[model samples]
Target: MSSSRRLTTVGFDADDTLWQNERFFRITERHFAELLSDHADHDHLSERLLEAEKRNLRLYGFGVKGFTLSMIETAIEVTEGRVPARTIELILQAGRDMLSHPVETLPGVRETLERIAGTHTILLITKGDLFDQERKLAQSGLGELFDGVEIVSDKTRTTYERIFAQHGDGAARAMMVGNSLKSDVVPAIDAGGWGVHVPHELTWVLEHVEPPTEHPRFLAIDHLGELSAIVEAIG
Candidate 1:
């Protein structure tokens, strides 16, 4: 935590950290529920969509397209193919809209990035479906702020180790900032880097995990903007 030993390379998580992502999917799912209301129970349809998403994560991975396909499959199953062609069109359109939608950075994201960019080698490290993450980074317009952008399929201790090695940085000189404790913090600390947890209000349940206590390298903040102070303190 010494200023001289402060982090030089900063790693960031993408979804729910740099931008508003998950909420949009949640809103679209509600619209999808409305579309199938006449054909199936709302709760039942929601459950089906969730189930399909879980199954498809293993098959197709995560993204808007997979979710759209899940909705279509759910419709076909629940309605016994009674779903009209127009309804299917609406579902597809919803997915397209989600993909094409403008990226909205969370409060303080741009300012914070701009403030920290000059002092650190900023790298965007995110895990998800490949194309979806690429499209999102293109839409964000803040891609230039990062020194590098990585779209990873998974986040684990080994993944961070690989990333740090690829960046040619010692683990002690690397720092990770993210919203998910499970995906972002644990592996980062385990890999011998500093972990900063910036909890988002709408975190997905699957991404939730308790942080380890008595760790000298683990820092937690309620807001993204608080990072500047911590970095400055460490520096």
Candidate 2:
């Protein structure tokens, strides 16, 4: 813990932390690579898409819609605007499939949230399209468990500071739990909040970053089930 005051508020990242998210994107990316094989090689198309996504992160932010748009742009670029209409249709279908996919909550997420809700103020602080994220929350059946939900354009130190300030007094008594080091853990720690990194199996490359090992409040746990114990220990 960074402060003497015990953690009073906990913020959870939605995708890949509480539920299965990146896997769907990965699957769709593979499907996309296959669809564009005539235009470019699988590896080349994959790299181009990733580059496009990164370049458009500012304009598009993070979400399935942004990803879908990036895929379209990448297709056009890689094929020199010669991508077949049928192939474009398949890409759009893949995006719709991702949007409509079932929300699969990760193991122990609901149970852990249920346990901790009794003691702390919980918030779902995730970044993505507002309607899409809200829909996912409704589908996840975990929306009622949170004190509030924030759908933001991006996750950064300033974002965490603002969220904690609004939800409570400051990050002094808050802890952020999520799977992305860049978006969840690092920025939370930078904002003076404790950060717990719960690693996911398939993480997006843009969200990848080295863990802050020397930080006093940084904790890495394999599973979210261990969060209750950490909260208790912090108290």
Give Cα-based local distance difference scores for all models. Answer: 0.85, 0.92
Pairs in clash, predicted candidate 1? none
Q: What digit string (tens of lDDT, one per residue) describes model 2 on residues 106-179?
A: 99999999998888889999999888898899999999999988989899999999999998658978999999
Off by over 4 Å in 2: 1-5
> Residues 1-235, candidate 1, lDDT per residue (tens digit)?
2346557778899899999888988889899889888877878888888888888877766667888899899988888989999999999999999888888888898888888887877889998778788888888888999888888877889988888778737667788999999989989999999999998878766687889767999999988999988877877
**Pick by lDDT: which candidate is best?**
2
